[model samples]
Target: MQIKPKFGVDQLLFGMKQTDVKSIYGNPNKQFKDEDQNVIYVYNQQKMRLTFYEDEDFRLGYIIASDPELTLFNNTILGRKATEVQKELEQHSFKTWEKEDFDLAENHFNEDHWLILQSEYDQIVKVEIGAIIKNQDEFDWKFGAK
Candidate 1:
């Protein structure tokens, strides 16, 4: 299925209600609330996970997709060679950063969103798209001022 690129997956983006997500992707395989009260929806068959912050009107805040069928705006497919994906992203003028094991590409259309490609050797094993929560101090405590 060709997924239309958006802030999130397809029409699912920041400020979209949970019901909207369900309407498009159907009910998640599993759902739960974290200790922080954020709702988590896992679609194992689709190889995707969506997270919504409880404080943010229960809107979609994060999306992780490892499905090979999913493709970015530039038609970059998940699980492709990292170099190939990098080239596709570069061709679209998206700024990229090379990490130790993976690479990160910032969405040129939306600064708050990012694409995380987990790589092994020279191949991308996973892909994640998510919004950057502004109040890192309150929401993301894992990485503190680093």
Candidate 2:
């Protein structure tokens, strides 16, 4: 399947994309979900004490940094999609549940969440985007003349 590159605030603001991200970073050590449904992707830049998550519809979210709250565009700290749902495991003592409809901005924190909750149109289901970052360093750059 063909995967088109998606854009986000960090990517648009910093001009970083997936390819640029992977070239200079490592893999995330943790991945979790919040109360909403936005999948939280976490990447550990051990030396920098930073973590990232990729949260959005298919591909709207960007790489979010933890600690200082620095966002690195184009790098998905966690290798998960917002539409993905992690089955509640038995060890965590959390029951298996699906993501309900909700927004990331209005209903949740911008640092914690990305968008706002505006789906008042039905019983919505979404994955919770916990404190994570989505690193998108996987595509080739097409902008600017280098």
Candidate 3:
């Protein structure tokens, strides 16, 4: 999986309509509703979960990726040391944040790119990327363009 920061992930982009996504990936292998009642498309082969916000016309909004081959700025981040991940992201013009998200795991977030990494025992375990919606009417969005 290639993380495009606040921009998007791989070929899937923020503000993309559900129809577009379905056309590209076909129907999700599995579908479920989140607590907010938003629809999530799960791709088992990709080890990826894509979230489409209902209020945003079911456009792409969030992504949860567990692939260890996750890449960003040409760097494979997952399964790497936290220190190494931080350095890689920083070298690519990302801001750094190292903290714990609710005590579940250590978190490294890049506000500049809207990316979050969850780590256990100092190794990144998951990669989260979400978009920033500026205007729903225009579908103007970028992952971290706040």
Top lDDT model = 3
TM-score of 2: 0.25
For residue 6, give model 1's deviation from the true position in Å. Answer: 5.9
lDDT of each: 0.64, 0.30, 0.78
TM-score of each: 0.71, 0.25, 0.85
Q: Model 1, 1-146: lDDT tens per residue?
A: 23333356655665566797788789999999999999999988778888888986677767777777777764757657766666666656656554553144322222333566666555565676666555653332111124
Give lDDT tens digits, candidate 3, residues 24-130: 77888999989988899998877889999888767788989997677888888777887787876666787668566656588877765668888887788888988
Instruction: State the TM-score for model 1.
Output: 0.71
Among the numbered candidates, top TM-score falls to 3
The segments of candidate 2 whose C-alpha lies over 4 angstroms from its true place after superposition are 1-26, 46-56, 60-63, 66-146
- Candidate 3: deviation at residue 146, Å? 18
How does candidate 3 fare on TM-score? 0.85
Model 1 CA deviation exceeding 4 Å by range: 1-6, 74-76, 102-113, 132-146
Residue 60, candidate 2: how far off, in angstroms?
Answer: 4.8
Distance from true position, residue 64, model 3, in Å?
0.5
